[model samples]
Each structure stands twice: as structure tokens, then as C-alpha cells.
Target: MSDSKHSGKHDREMLLEMMHSTTKTSAEDLLISYKGILYPSVLCCLETFQALETFEAREDDILVVTYPKSGTNWLVQILYEMVSIVHNKEPLLDTTMIEFGSPEILARFKDRPSPRIISTHLQFKNIPKSMFEKKVKILLVLRNPKDTAISFYNFHNSLPPLPSYNSWNLFFKDFISGKVCYGPYFEFVAAWDNHFNDKTMMAITFEEMKVDFPTALKKISEFCQLPLNEEQIDLVARCTSFNSMKEQSENTHGKLGDSFFRKGEIGDWKNCFTEDQSKVVDEMFEKYLAGTKLGKMLNYAKYCKW
Candidate 1:
């Protein structure tokens, strides 16, 4: 082999060696908190989360995306029901959690038909620029971080056959450490909002969806360029209802059945947090989002029911 080729091979090996030697953060070790923001250390494995938008989407395709526990299931069911009513297709009923996100765009979803509807939790940095540049139809859902945490606490704590986190203190630590799916939640949201433009992205809040179901549904249908008459809206509503999601959580999602829908109600954070816990979250938020839009979005003026 040529000396230059040998040198190139050696450099590549060295880079891989350094990465292996590096003490990478584990999923359980990230502790990002502050102003309802999480900014834990991250590995770039998330960079592999992209697939072609047009490659996976047809001219008629659409997507619903969110951080975990941020009403992802609800949106999925809503969109599925909407599509079902509009096209009279069988409910895109698949019972695996893997189908929950943009995995549907990858080889894993090679079998899904055209005019596909997909989901994903990936931040823009993790995905291909090509996809976003395509300006595909996107429905991004944001939840109040405070409520997101409470929901996450309930969902993970209730898991069967997993290590039971018996104390709120320990779980909070894990949250601060960025040990959960969609960890550093604030960072993920900020990245999405900042990197992507508004036209292709229609960002909604969980609070809005809960407060105004019909309005949220109309906004989404319009974003996807599919208008539904009043009767059709009712059909979509019935299908994405909380009870409906809870009933088929395990059936429609990847795994972990009914557990997926434990208490979809908001402000449940009050059920567990003490005055002291509130202080902890406040401290972290102060450090992470002190003067940014996130800090402003956090709005100390905005009261959390906790």
C-alpha cells in the first residue's frame, strides 16, 4: 500500500481509539436542569437520526414530532385518526414503540406505503440538513417543561420489570442529569426552534392541545394541507381521545402498554414535588437559561401550579 494510504488509515484508527477511551456520558448520568431547562453533556450519536424527507415523504406526507411524554402518543393517534377518516384507510395500527417516531422514515419502515405519516424526537443537529431544507410538513409539539417532568416521572416510575425508582429525590436527580429520553429537553426544543424556520414548522404546546382540542386539530389539519368538515373533525377527536390512547397504548405504540397513558392530566407535578424540590428546579433553571429566549419563555412571571 502507498505510504499516504497507510498514514490515513492510522489517523482514522487513532480517532476511533480516542473516542473509545473518552469517558462518554451514559443515558443515566446527564443532569440538565434550570429554568425548566436541561443541558447535560451529550454524545453525537444523535447525529445519525436523519433520513431523507422527500425520500421518505411523498408530496402528500406529514409528520408529528415531540419530546417523549410530551403528548407524542396523543398526536400520533390524532393524525392516524385524521388520515383514516380522510382516506378510509385501516387505522395505521402497529403495536410497537419503534414506530412512534421518525424510525418510520428509515429502513425499519421500508414497508410503509406512500403518503406516509411519520414521527420523530430528533433535534435538527441530529438529522440531515437535506430533510429540513426540503421544507416538509412538520408538526412540532412543545409542553410546559414543568408538566413534562411530572409526566415523565409518572411514566418511568410506573414501568413494569424495570428498576423501580422508589423516591422522588432520586428521579429528580436523574432528570437533572439528563438520564431520560429527550434529555436536556430545553436544549432540544431551543435547537429545533432556532435552527428551523417557522414556515415548515408549526410548533404547538401541550397546554393548547389540552385546552382547545378542536382548535389544535384544525391547526394541524391546515398545516398538513388537509381540511376536514365538522363531522370528520369529530371522528378524529374520538380516535385521539385520552381514553382511546390509554386503551391501545401498548397496542399502537412500541411496547409498555397502558403504562403509556398514566394520568394525561396536567399540573400533576403537585402530586409529588415539595417546596424544596421546586427550589432545586429553580436553581438549575437560573444557571442554564438565565438570559436567553428559553429564560424568557420560562417567564418567571408565568406561574407553575407546582
Candidate 2:
């Protein structure tokens, strides 16, 4: 075989080896390693990974990117409502996240009309290259790592396909080590830091949204160019509130249920993270995110400090 073909064969072999190894441990079985990043095997398949390489992004597409449990669903709901206002109709929400489905499932999106809002938990490096080339508008949602970790732990336990930990301590070890799906929280934040200044991207924190929903909604409307009037914005705010979403969870999330709307608070991590665990996350933050522009945007001292 030619050199390029030989390398492709080797990479496939490595992926298969990693998948097989997952069967040996409960923690390992929860995620599959692909190109050095872990993804929930239950939701991602080999075909999905291959399809992402060639996924087409349109110029008008609005991509909502976030690490897992970083308020992705909440942001999507807000965006959907904004779109509904502009079109004067409440379109049924498309919650099939980009990287979580098969290539065949992803192919279905091509038929959807323009101004599509696509959501994904994929890391920066894994996003389709076509997105950058097309200059698609990206809205990145960030959460303080401590709260993110705690939310992630609860999510895993509640979802049947995801692995459940016997205790938070066991999950904490995997999380801090970057062994969870989508890899380390610190690295995920740092990777996106490179694009903080991009004209096509807007970075918003979950804490910021919780503190001021209307202001955040206005920012999103401006970023999306949807230009909702103040009255429309207020209506969307009331409809998408945490309680409203939680009550509608059965219809919105289907089998996933209300776990998607649990708590939605900023500092729930305090109840779950031990003193040492908190320090570990703090040091990791210091090492990877302390001086970066994204870190500043997160307001680490205010939101992440214990």
C-alpha cells in the first residue's frame, strides 16, 4: 500500500483497539477514544466521526458549541425562540445534536431550511473544517469547571446510556484526568481561547446568563442578527426559564426527561466537590486557563473561586 493508505489503516487499527479496551472496565466503557478525544460511545459511532470530516456548513448556519453540560440545551432553546419570533411561527425544535448521531442521521439535516441552528459537544479541533471556511456564526457557552464537573456527574448517572459512578469521588478522578467524554475541561476552555477574538464568534458564560437572562438574550439576538424587539425578547425569556423548560422537559428531551433541566444553578458544585477536589480543579485552571482571554471572560475569580 502507499504511505497515506498505510497510515489510514494504522489509525483504524488504533481506534478498534481503544474500543475493545473499553469492554474491560466500567469507566472505560462509558466513552470511546477517537483521535485522542473521548466521546460517548452510546451516541457516537465510527460513521459519525468520518462524516464530520466532510460535513458541509452553510454561511447562515448558527453553530452552538459547548463542552458537555455547559448549558447547550438552554442556549439552543433561546436560539429557537429567537428564530420563532423572526419567522412568526414556532417551528418544532431540532434537538438532534450534530456529533451525537450517525452519518445517515446527520444527512437528514441537509434538507432543513437555512438559518439552521446546530448544536454540538465536540471540542474545537473536532469541529468540521468547513465551518471555519464558511465563516458560520458560532456562539460558545462556557461554565465554571467546578459546576460543570458536578453537572456532568449527575447527567451521567441520570442518563441510561451514560456510565453511572458509584460515587462522585470515582467520577471526579476520571473527570480531572480528562478521561471523560470530550476530554479535559481545562483544555477544552483553552482550545477555544484561540478564537475569542474572531469576528464570527461570541463567547458567553452560563453564569452570565443566569445572572441576567434578558441581557444575555439581547446579546444572542444581536450576535445572531435575528434582531428581536424588546417585547419579543421578554416573551422568549419567560418561556425558556428554567422552570418552564423543566415542566416541558418530557416533550423537549423525550426519554432524557428533566435531567437536562436539573438545578441550572451556578454553584451547585460546592455541595459535591471536596476541598481537595476543589484545589485540584483550581490548580488545573491556573495551569491552563488563568491568563487566557477566555478565562477572563469566564470571570474565574468571581464564579469559579470557592
Candidate 3:
């Protein structure tokens, strides 16, 4: 078992190296080389930085993980609704008990209630070891790659201190290279894929979440071990829709961020990618994602595959 685990880790590292070749220069690396060329140093730094040192987890903790621009906010909303439904609690919007700051969230293992739900964009290695070791529940949400990249590009552009968008082409290049934070999506997804199990963890696709909200709610309900009645299941489904979240976001003054619904429509990538551009991306996705188990449950259009 140990030899196989080490072998798996070795193979995973090699795969990340290949993906890193396509990543872009990060904010920190730009100071060293103002030139557009990307260096491997950025990848090295990420692997090192992502290696979490001190770690811990409580048995009852619930974690929702996703690459950036995936359905993180929606997952958070879903879990919130789950708690509210199962426990007959009030709406979660006006309280910090359910939602807290980044620092507060990382320390979730410290002082949280039973059946804790915490959402994070942290890469696999950055996660607390105790959680995986103790078999804590983790729900990974994935979206389609093209849409994920597009959503991330738009999200970064919309940030207060906007940076690059040399063109969709350059962004595409850097994206494949794994230069962007919380990317390349395939690597993040694959590296953590093996840890999944019905007991400790489960991987659910955004397309699944999109196609049938009620079914998605059902899966989450089962994972949470709180059986829901017909009415509660219906409410959970209604609560996670793009329209409903958008309404909440507006009411909250958009404070929830793009995690709510960056853009709900499927195939929005068609608008952003020309025929040639789409062709390039398809090639990139094939090269990067082929032969991974992550591909089986993920079909580019098989709902929103990210």
C-alpha cells in the first residue's frame, strides 16, 4: 500500500510538471522578469507553497473544495440551505456563524460545531492533513474547463486591482501552463481525485448540479446524512439556482462575489472563443486532460464540465 501510494505521488508530481509548462507568470514572478516569457520557478514556488505544514481536522467537519470560478459559491449556498432545512434554522445571510473570514475559515478545525461546512479554493496540498487522515467529508465541485477558464478570466478582470488580459490567446496559454492561481483545473481535480469515497468524500460535477438541482441536493443530502422530506428537497433545489442566488446577491449588494453565478448560461464559451480559438483550446484540453479519471465523470459539454 505504501509503495503504491508513493508511486502515485511520483506520477502525480510528473503530471503537474507537464501542466506547469503551460502556466503563466504569477504576480510575484513578474517582478523578476517583466518580459512576457514564463519561468518554471513559478511552478516550483506553488508546489512548495501549497505543501501545508501544521494541520488538523474534526471528524464532523464538512469541506467544499473547488478550483476558482467553479461552483464554490453555489455549493456554499447549498450547504447553508441544507443546514437551515435540516435544523429548522433561519436564513444564513445576516450571520457570521455560518460564514466567516478566510483566516477564520482555515481554523475551522479549532472551534466549530458539529457537521461543519467550510468552503475553500486552496489546492489539494494546502488542505489540512488531519481531515483526509481522519476521513472528513469533502465535496469537490467541478465545472467545464473552457467555461471555468472564461469565468476565471472574467473574475480576475473584474477584481479591483485588475491585471492581464493580453488576449484570450495569451490567457489561454498561461491558463494551460498552470500559471494562474487555482489552476490548471485538471491537475487540481486529478491530484485530489483519489481521495474520494462515499464515506470520506464525494466528487460531483457542476453539470450534474446544473441539470437537476433536486438530484444534486439529494446527493448532498445523503452525504450530510440528513434525510430530507419532499418539501425540504424541493426547497434546497430552488435555493441553489442561478436566479435565486442572483436575487440573494443583489439583496446582499453583490457581497457574496462571483461565487453566486458568474454567468449561468451554458456554452457561454462559444461567445468568447472563435472557431480557431476554440480549436486551440480543444487541443489544449485534450493534451492536458486526456487519460485521467477526472475525464470519465467530466464531459466538456456533458452540462458545464469544469
Candidate 4:
């Protein structure tokens, strides 16, 4: 085998060994290193990661990309509802999240019908290259890092496959240090900011969607060329409201339950972030995201600040 192939094989073996050896007492223990990025061992594996390099993205596919806890499922529900309205059919949520399954599970999506909605928490750099080459439309979601961190902390503790933190303090340290699965929140936002102006991508913030659902839904419709009449948009808005989704969580998420829905509030971080922790997040934003388009889009001063 070629040296590169041999190296890839060795890396997979080492990662599997590491994953099996750990008791998963901490975030570091439950994550596997793939191409220098950390991924939850339960959600990602080497085969799926490698297959993504050559994964064929349909031209009409809509890829919803977000960092964890950045309103991904919310957007997915809205998108599904929008398309269902356009087609005059009942909406069925497609949770064919690209990065969360094995190679075989990923392969199963190959034959899925047109206009597939693929979701991922993977950073922009890690997404399938064919997506860009095929010019697949991407809806990128951004959330204030403070809220993202808070929701992510709750998510980790609630999800059994993930390592649970004893307190927000420990999760906050891991979150800020880029030690959590999928790496640093700041870097993930910055990496996608590089492609924000790309013709195939549209970026939106979670706070915007929360404040004005109809306007946000309209923007998404225009970007994806999926027309939604005002009536239909209203229906989607009502169905996707955090409370509505939370009430239907067991039906929507099955055993995953309401943990996936959580609070979905814009500034719930205030309840969890200590004064010093908030300051650290502010400093990190300045250091990594300040003055960037994504930062401006996030409107940090309005949503993230006191």
C-alpha cells in the first residue's frame, strides 16, 4: 500500500484502540482525533470521515451546517416543513445527519430522493468537498458562543453517549479550550466565515430566527429557491416554535426525548455563565471572532452582552 494509505489505516486502528481503552470519564476520553479534529466517538468514525472526502453531493441538496447547539434541528424542522408545504405533502423530518453515522449508514443516503436535507455539526473544512464542487446550497447557522456553550453543557450531560460534566465550570473550560467534540466554537465560526460570501452559502444567526421567525423563514426560502406563501410560513413558524417543538419532542426525537430541544432561549446563558466565565467568553470572542462578518452577523453586543 502507498504510504498515505498505510498512515490512514494506522490512524484508524489507533483511534479505535483509544476509543475502546477509555472509560469516557471526560470529554477527552469520549472523543476521537480524526485529521486533527475531535469528534464524538459515538457519532463519528474513521470510515465515515474518509468516505466524506469522495461523498457525492446532489446539486439540489440543502446542507444545514452548524456547531452543536446552534439551532440545527430547529432549522431542519423549518426546512422540512417549507419543502413539504411547497410539495403540498405532509412534512417528514429527515435526520440523515452526515457526520453522526457509520459509513454504511451514510451510504444509505446515496439513493435518497432529490432535494435531500443533510445536516452536520462538522466544521466547514471537514464537510464533503463534493458539496462545494457540486455547488450544493448550504445554510450555515451561528449562535452566540455563550448560549452555545450553555446549551452544549446541558446537551452533554443529558446525552448518555457523551461524557457528562459535574458542573458548567468544567464544561466551560473544555468548551473554551476547544477540547470538546468538533473542537473550538470560535474556530468553527471563523472557518465558515471564510466562505460566507460563497455563492452556495447563506449564514444566519440563532438569535435572528428566535426574534423574527417569519423574516428568517423568508430569507431561508429565498436562499433555497423554495417559495413559501405567507400562510405556509406562518404554519412553519407556529410548528417550529421552541415550545411547540419541545411539546412534540418525544414524538420527534423518540428516546432522545426533550433533551434535544432544551430551552432554545436566546440569553439563557445568563442563568449559567458566571461573571468571570462571561468575561472569558467575551475575551475569546475578541481574540478570535471580533470584527469578522460572522461576529457582526451574530450581533454579539446585542445578544451576548449584558
Per-model TM-score versus the true fold = 0.72, 0.90, 0.74, 0.89
Off by over 4 Å in 3: 1-52, 91-105, 161-166, 251-260, 301-306
Off by over 4 Å in 4: 1-29
Scored by lDDT, model 4 comes in at: 0.82
Judge candidate 1 at residue 149 and give its lDDT: 78
Worst 10 residues of 2 by lDDT: 1-10
Poorest lDDT segment (10 consecutive residues) of candidate 4: 1-10
Cα lDDT of model 3 by residue, 1-306, tens digit:
012333433322322323323334445642221123222232223222233345456687778888877787778778878887777786443222111122322333355455667666666766767768878888888787878878877765544322447577777777777767554666677677654565677788877778777888888889877689889899877777888878777444244344335676667776677677667656765765656556666775453332
Q: Which candidate, 1 or 2, would have the higher TM-score against the true structure?
A: 2
Q: What is the C-alpha lDDT of each candidate?
A: 0.59, 0.82, 0.61, 0.82
Candidate 3's error at 273, in angstroms? 1.6
- Residues 1-306 of candidate 4: C-alpha lDDT, one tens digit per residue: 112332433332323333334455655656789978887776677888898888999999999999989998899988888888887777756455687656765675787776788889888888898998899999999999999999999988877557889988998999999988889999999898877756889999899998987999999999998998888788989988889989987766655656688788889999988899989999999988899988899999998887
Estimate the lDDT of model 2.
Answer: 0.82
Off by over 4 Å in 1: 1-59, 95-105, 160-163, 250-255, 283-306
